[model samples]
Target: MGNEKETPEERRERMRQRELSNPSSSGHGSNLSDLVGGLGWKGTGLLILLIITGFVVYSLATGN
Candidate 1:
């Protein structure tokens, strides 16, 4: 009986308050960690592509 339904706005506000109360729990860390942690398949593919491109460029520069 004590538990009442919360409206959408109320629920959103409650969640916002909870997030504000615990800043660390928000999952935002250092910029580098955030960038690395947020990487997905696309980022991984791009990293691979960059590595291959770098190898090719290095070999070309070395005439190898």
Candidate 2:
């Protein structure tokens, strides 16, 4: 009994209290990891494209 896990409702309430205490970090936009988690394969491709574009731009700018 002492080592029992918290119920879902209790966990949610705890999260709500935490968010109420620290508003910024708990907001929807602040949940960057969760937001990015749903990007899946498309997000990965976009990230790769951006990285490649940045590298190309940097190389051209530096004449390297």
Candidate 3:
């Protein structure tokens, strides 16, 4: 989308071809690391914190 050399149609086609080539994965990579990696190292920490928070919340809520 940022390429100045390509027209809108070209961009659309390029995107279409990219999607066609990797139909199983979305732009976020369809994986936890890929999704968090886009946000850099902080995202990893945030994800871990979220997981821990969820576990703690669950444990507290269920007396587990």
**Which structure among the candidates has the greatest lDDT?**
3
RMSD from true fold, candidate 2: 5.4
Tell me the TM-score of each prediction against the true structure.
0.42, 0.42, 0.50
Model 3 lDDT tens row, 1-64:
4598889999999988998798775746367655876878887788889999999999999998
- Residue by residue across 1-64, what tens digits does model 1's lDDT show? 4227887888889889997798788677556555656897689678779989999999999999
- TM-score computed on alpha carbons, candidate 2: 0.42
In angstroms, what RMSD does candidate 1 have relative to the true structure?
7.7
Candidate 2's C-alpha lDDT? 0.79
Candidate 3 has a TM-score of: 0.50
Q: Which parts of model 3 have CA positions greater than 4 angstroms off?
A: 1-29
Clashing pairs in 3: none
Q: Score residue 14 of candidate 1 by CA lDDT.
A: 85
Pairs in steric clash, model 1: none
Error of 1 at 6 (Å): 39
